[model samples]
Target: MRGDSWTESYLRSDIMRESVIYQAILEEGELSAKLTSIPRLLVLGLTREQIAQALDLEIEQVPQVIEGQN
Candidate 1:
């Protein structure tokens, strides 16, 4: 019964295995390092000051990193 339910859920969505969002969700901690990337960190609504604090970086260094990305 448990195996049947697992198979049912897996087959319910025809595109689950090919879905980027689903794959990303399954990756779990695989993206932990990317979470600290400046652009990704900014997209998650972190301010420069907050990012600097979290990364142990100088507050002034944040803008330079942002500028270089542009």
Candidate 2:
């Protein structure tokens, strides 16, 4: 009975893995140290100023680290 229910659910397309784009967005907070800020910015909706404010860093430095990501 349990196996039949699972097979029916799979065939019905109600349970599926997340899309790659959504997975990428979910992984925004997990970039490596070298790619941290920039990749995070690309993956999410936060602006440089907002990120800088949240990080307690200089606003000018945000551009340097997050360049070409826009």
Candidate 3:
């Protein structure tokens, strides 16, 4: 049946990894982690430019994330 096959496929790690939704979730988590680390990096004396380069984020995005923290 279609429902059984869908369930089986969903349970497979390879199939789940190939899913668009799964990829989006992974991207979101990665971004969240990067954003969370910004403050710590700043405290450690890294400049916004350095953090942006280190995290592979936009230079503009670093200030925005910094602003959001306050």
TM-score of 3: 0.74
Which ranking of candidates, highest TM-score first? 3, 1, 2
Residue lDDT tens for model 3, 1-70: 9999988877886676669787898899999999999999999999999999999999999999889978
| Candidate 2 whole-model C-alpha lDDT, 0 to 1 | 0.65
Better of 2 and 3 by lDDT: 3
Write candidate 2's Cα lDDT for 1-70 as tens digits: 9999989988666434446566776666443443466557646988877777766667786787766455
What lDDT score goes with residue 62 in model 2?
Answer: 74
12-40: candidate 1 lDDT, tens digit per residue: 66566668677787665444443347677
Give model 2's clash tally: 0
- Runs of candidate 1 with Cα error greater than 4 angstroms are 1-36
Which candidate number maximizes lDDT? 3
Task: Report the number of the highest-TM-score candidate.
Answer: 3
